[model samples]
Target: MRRLGSALLAVSMFAGCGGLETEPSPESLTSPSFESQQAPITTTDVDVAPECKGIITFVNTATFQTLDAYLPSNVVTNLVNRRATAPFTSLADVSSVSLVGETRLKQLEQGARARGAINSTCVGIFDGLALSTSDAAAIVSLVNTIDDSELHDVLPDAWNGAANLLNLRPFTSAQAISNVAGIGEVSFRNIRNAATLSRPFEALAAAVNAIPSNGSAGVQLKRHFDWWNEVTAQHGYSQGGPTCFGLEPSSVPYGATIRPYLANSAEVMAEVQSTLDYVDADTKISPNVIAAGMANLSARTQGRSFKGCIFSYADDPWSRHNVAIFVDTVNGFSVFSETWWAE
Candidate 1:
C-alpha cells in the first residue's frame, strides 16, 4: 500500500469490513438478491522499463503551470478527487483481521466472477482507479507496444467504453459526437478492477521515474491523488448559505475531470429498479411507488448524481423509474447513496 514515486498504490488487502454494515435503503433492496463479488487478480510481474524510470504518469499542476519547483505532483489529485480513501492500511490495521482472512479474499474473488453476468448496476466493482476513453486508448496503445496485446484481450469492453465515455468533455455546438451518444456514467467499481490498475501503480511509478525531470507525469500524478482524497472525504450535500459550494472537494481544477466516473444510460436503466429504495417516503404515490421514493431519496441524499436519473414524468410511479435521470454532464446518480449501497 506504499506510495512509490509519483504513482499511487492501488492494491486491496483485507480492509476491515466493519461488520455487514447495514442494509441498503428500501429502494436499493427491492431486487432482493445478494450475490457475491469477485476479488481482484494479483500479479507480481507488472513489468516496467528500466529506461522509463524517470517518466511521470501524472503532472503537478501547481508546479507545471506556475513553474514552481517545490509543489507536490498532481497524480494525488486524481485519487483523492474520486473519494477513494484507504479503507485499510496494512492488513493488520483492520479492526477485525479475522474477518478478512485468506478465506474471505478467495470468496470475494469467486463472488466477483459470478456477479459479472448481472447488469452493471447490480454489480458494484470498483478497484479505485478509472481511465477516460482517451486515457484508455492511450493505455491500450501502450499495452499493445509493451505487452503486445489488445486492450480488450486484457481488459473488459465495458472498461474500454467507460474510458472513452469519461474523457467526453464539453465542446461547442459544432463538435464531433462519436462515443458521446447514449453515454452515461462509468462505474467507479469497474475501473478500480482493471488488471492494469492493481493496487499500487508500481509499474507506472517505474515508468515515470525513468523519464527526465522535465516530464510532467509525476506532478500530474500528485494532483490526481490529492484531489481524490479531498473528493472522497468531502460531504456529498451542500447547504444553502451566503456562498455556493460543492459537497465534494475538487482536486482537478474543473468538475469535468470526474464526470466520466458515473453510471452510463444503460447502467442507469439497470439501476432504476433498485434505486427506488432510496426515495423519500413522503413522495410515495402508486404501484412500485417504493422505487420512485428511492429515486427521490437518492436524488436528494446522493446529490446531483442521482438527479441525473430523472424519469420521463414525475406523477406515474413506474414512469418515475422508466427513464434515466441525469443533469448536465453527470450520469448515474443512485450510487451516490453510499448509505444505501453499503453491505
Candidate 2:
C-alpha cells in the first residue's frame, strides 16, 4: 500500500470490507492543491519562564468583540468585569474568572498565542505552532491512526523511530509521542510537522468516514456537510447562515486572502452537476430543483473566484451518492455547498 500522494484519490467505501477504489478521471473531480497553494509557515521560538504575560495582556487589552470570537460570551463578560477592576496578573488570575476551566483556559491561551499575544513558552511540542484546538486534535488523530509505512513516508528522516510509534499505538496526546523509544525531540517535531502538513487530506478522510454507508442520500450529504462545518470552525473559519436550498457558505477565516487554484467556479459547478446526476439516479429529488439550487449557488458566488477542490464519491456504489465541495474565497473564507434531496 503506497502513500496517497498530494492528490490523494484513495476512496474508502463504508460498506462491508472497505477497500481502496480507483481514482476517478481528472475531468470528474479536482484534486486538492495543497502542494502549490500552501504558503510558507513561520514559527517563533519561545524560551521563557512559566509566566504567560502574553495571555494576560490579550485578556486585558483585547476588545470585547475580538474576545467574543475566541470565548463564550458569558466567560468574556466575566473576564472583562474581572479585568476592569483588576487586570489579570497570571494565568491563575484568568482561570479564576467564572466559567474559565482548564479547557477554556487552553482555548484562550491558543487564541492569544495565535494573535502573537503569547510570547512565553507553553507545554506541548505543538505549543509554538499556535494551532487551534481542532488542528491539534487532528494531528493527534493522525499520529494514533497512521501506520508505520505511512509514518515513515511522511517522516523519512525519522524512519528509524517509526516502529516505536506504531508499537505504542493510540497515543493519548501528541506530547505522548515523546515517551516512545528512539523518538527524540527532532523526531517528535518532524512527526508533528508532517501531521500539520497533511491536515487537509486528514480532514477529507474524516469527513468521508463520517457518512453512513446505508442511509438516504440526503442524510449522508448532510452528515458530510455538518462534519466539514464543525472541523473548519475548529480551525477558526467562520460560518455563514444556514443552507439555502442545499447550498450554504463554507467556513473561512475573516480577512483571509483567497487564492483561487485547482479549479474555477465553472469547473466546480460542472463537477457538482455530475455528482447531482449520480444522486438523482436513485433519489426522489427532481433534476429541475437541483438545477435551480445550483443556479442559486452560482448566482450567489458569481464573479467570485475560488481555490480548492471538489471530492466526488461516485466511484464507490455505497458512497457514490456523496460529494464534498471545498473552495476558498479572496476573504480567506471557504465556501461550501450541501446538495440535498428529500428521501
lDDT, candidate 1, 1-343, per-residue tens:
1000012323322222222222122232223332122123222222111111111111101113221122223422332232133333221222123334333322332332232322222221112212223323333333223211112222223434434443543322111212244322223222222323322333322232333332211111110121222232323222211111221332122222233243343443344333333342224324344343334333323333221211121222221212222221222112211111111
Question: Where does candidate 2 have its weakest 10-residue lDDT segment?
Answer: 4-13
Expressed as tens digits, the lDDT of each residue in 1-343 for candidate 2 is 2221112112221121111122122222122421222122211111111223345455666667767789989988888777657656544456678898756776777766666653333332232233333434555776787544346544545555777777777877655665676776455555554544433323333343354433445333220122233322322222221121111224332333333334456755565555445444225454454444555446534565554323322323333322344333332113343433323
Best by lDDT: 2
Model 1 scores what on Cα lDDT?
A: 0.25
The 0-to-1 C-alpha lDDT of every candidate, in the order given, reads 0.25, 0.44
- Best TM-score goes to which candidate? 2
Give the lDDT of residue 319 in candidate 2: 32
Query: Where in model 2 is the C-alpha error above 4 Å?
Result: 1-136, 179-277, 280-343
The TM-scores, one per candidate, come to: 0.18, 0.30
